[model samples]
Target: MKVYISADMEGVTGLVDAEDVQPPGRDYERGRGMMTEDVNAATRGAFAAGAAAVLVNDAHGPMRNLLPDLLDPRALLIKGRPKPMGMIEGLDSSYDAVLCVGFHARAGVLGVLSHSFMGHEIEDIWLDDQVTGEIGLFEATASAYGVPVVLLTGDDTACAEAVAWNSSIRTVPVKYAKDRFAAQLVPVAEARSAIEAGAREALRSLPSAVGAGARTLSVRWQSASVVSHLTAIPGVARRDDRTVTVTADMPQLYRLFNLFLRVATAVTSNPPYC
Candidate 1:
């Protein structure tokens, strides 16, 4: 089996605040270390489960958070962003399964450090009329390539969301959320064990964890101006001041979603666009 891992920072073990996931924060470096360890655990587990190869994509801000030198030597890492596929970049039908590590709840949800792709711009993401967080978005992208999301690790809310999307998916909840920036967490060692075990169990379950069929995707921005800026893309329709809707097959929808995020990010934070 070939396994692909998409890793994020917000849901890593012991992460409960923005400072943990961003630079200049006292614990930021520690958070990256924890994130790397968690991903290594998952990769190790996948190899133990008979996976012939594993690839990890760093899916957080700037997409370069994962420390390449410390990552598991067995797996290849895709870092940095502005890529066509974004989170699920390099994913294709060739992979046997995909895994989401250190993921968080959707925007406005009660998970620790909860937010969609761009917390400052996206208020919610909709797929086929259902509200979905980052978990759903990445799953859809993987599904588009005929890959199943076998495992997910994060806080309680993120784990719950994974199972809700696909009951067969295995999840390792490293922490229980008390609020947006507060969580009851297990020690790093325990969290690593859980992730490793969860990856093995999820892969062992096989075909049951893979499901794909997304027809429409949409997003609601934090404000009308953000949505207005995104509507400039052809085929993207303005649903309302805060919402924009797009109808496409899974692959197209995934690309459109990434495009929306990139444009939104540029408009909101990048000065050149402003």
Candidate 2:
């Protein structure tokens, strides 16, 4: 069995500020180490459960959060910025399953550093009218390729949010979110162990179906012009003042998502647009 891990940063232990998630800052370095530890736990678990291989995609900002030097030598790391698939670069139908690491609750969720893609620009995201965080949307896309999301690790709010989609999915809550920047944390060692257990269980008892479906991403922005700006993309629809939705025929929503939203982020953050 091959496993794919999508690693993000907001829900990692001790990550309580925006500065922690950004590059060139002191906390970012520290946070990346924490992120790597979490991924390593999952990878170790997959191995313990008899996984043949694993691919880890650095799903956090800049897509370079995890240091290969600290990563498990057994698994491959897909890193860097501007990749075709942002968070999920190497996903395909062949992978047996996927795991989400250090993921946060959706926008407006009560949790540490909680927000959707842009935080400031995106208010919410929906697939098939169900409000979803990055986890849910990624789960849907992964399912489209016949891969199941077997494991998730994050804050309590994120775990709670994930349980809404699938009760059977295993979760490791590294922190209990008290607010956007504050959470009650489990120690690094404890969190890592829980992650390993969740990963082992998810892979060992793999679900029969991962809920595959059409790949469509609907983004709710903070303003109308952001919607107008994104309309330049072919086949994109401006649903209203605050939303723009895109549909893809393939399971590569992550790449298309990066293209459109990176542009949206630039446009909306500009003075005249917001």
Candidate 3:
């Protein structure tokens, strides 16, 4: 079986602030090591569960947080940004399963480092009228490719979010959120153990198939200017002063969302979460 992993930094064990996940911060380097170790734990579990090959995509900001030199040699890594599929880059129908490592909860929720795709720029998102964060969006896209999300790792709220999206999917909580930038962490060793075990067990009883279909994706941004800029794109309509809606299938919908981010980035000068 083939396993795909999408690793994000904010939800990794021991990380509780932007300084921990964003670069140039005093602890960002240490956070990179922590992120790499978490991915390694998942990678080892995938192999133990009889995976023939594993591909990992660095899915955090900049998409370069994982240290390649320290990564598990058995799995291939996809690092860098501007990927067409973003977090789920390199994922496809051929993969048997997908694992989301170190993911935080969606914007407006109480979870460590909680924010949507573009940090605070995105106020909220809805997929076919269902409110969703990155977890739900990625899960939906993966399902479109016939790949089930077998396991997810993050804080307690993030884990719960995943279960809400798909109860059958297993989750390992590395920390308990006390606030958006603070959490009670699980010891590194203990968290890794749980993650490895969860991955092994999740893959053992794979679902027969994951249902997928075309849907509408709506994004609410923090700035009216961002929404105004996005409406310039074809097929994207203004939902309101600060919201835009688009209709598309998986992968395409996913790509369009990223394109919207690019446009927003070009026009907005405010930092994330400001």
Candidate 4:
């Protein structure tokens, strides 16, 4: 089996605040080490389950959070920005399964460092009326290529969301969230063990179940200017002052979502743009 793994920092064990996940912060360096270990554990599990190849995508802010030198030598790493797929970059029909490691809950949810695509700019993202975060979006996008998510590792809320999305997919919650910035964490060693076991089981079991065949992706932004800018794009409809809706299926839906993300990222907070 071949697998694609996407790694993020916020939900990694022992990390709870922006100081840990964001760059140039006091704790950011330590957090990346933890994230790297978590990815290595998952990769080890994949290899143990007979996976022939694994690709780890650094999917967090700046898209370059993982420590490549610390990653499992068996797995290839993809890191950088301007990636159209964001989290699921490099995903294609050739892969048999996907593993989402170190993910958090959607914006406005109770999870350690929770937020959707763009931390402060996005309010929520919906797929065919179902409120979704990065997990849901990644699952849908992978499904578009006929792939399923075999294992997901994150906080308690993120694990719950995974089960709600697809019960068959395995989950490992390294921490239980007390709030957005705090959690009751499992020791790093224990978390690594759980992730390795879960990844092995997930790949050894049946294929991951595909999610709903969503036809629309609706985004509610935190700023009206984002809504205005997105509306100018052909086929994007303004649903309200803060919401814009787009229609597309599977792969295209994923593509348009990223396009909107890039556009929304450019919306300035200064006047005239705000």
The candidate that achieves the highest lDDT relative to the unseen native structure = 3
For residues 107-183, write the lDDT of model 4, one tens digit per residue: 88888888887886888888889999888888888887889888899999999998897777789999999988889
Q: Which numbered prediction scores highest in TM-score against the true structure? A: 3
Name the lDDT value of residue 2 in candidate 2.
92
The Cα error of candidate 2 at residue 78, in Å, is 0.5
Q: Candidate 2 has what TM-score?
A: 0.93
TM-score of each: 0.94, 0.93, 0.98, 0.95
Supply the TM-score for candidate 1.
Answer: 0.94
Residue pairs in clash, model 2: 113-180
lDDT ranking, best first:
3, 4, 1, 2
Residues 1-274 of candidate 1: C-alpha lDDT, one tens digit per residue: 8899999998899999878988767889998889999999999899999999999999888788898899989999999868898888889989989889999988878998888877756777888888998888788777777788989999999989888977767889999999988999999899999899989888986763344554778788776877888878888888888999888778778878888777776667632101
Q: What lDDT tens digits, residue by residue, belong to model 3 across residues 1-274? A: 9999999988899999888888888999999999999999999999999999999999998999999999999999999988988999999999999989999899999999898988888989999999998999999999988999989999999999999989988999999999888889899999999999999889888985565667999999889999888888899999899989998897899999988888888988767644
Where does candidate 3 clash, by residue pair?
none
List where candidate 4 sits over 4 angstroms from the true fold: 208-214, 269-274
**Runs in model 1 lying further than 4 Å from the true structure:** 208-214, 270-274
Model 4 Cα shift for residue 121 (angstroms): 1.5
**Per-prediction tally of clashes:** 1, 1, 0, 0
lDDT of all the models against the reference?
A: 0.85, 0.81, 0.92, 0.87
Q: How would the candidate models be sorted by TM-score, starting from the highest?
A: 3, 4, 1, 2
Clashes of 3: 0
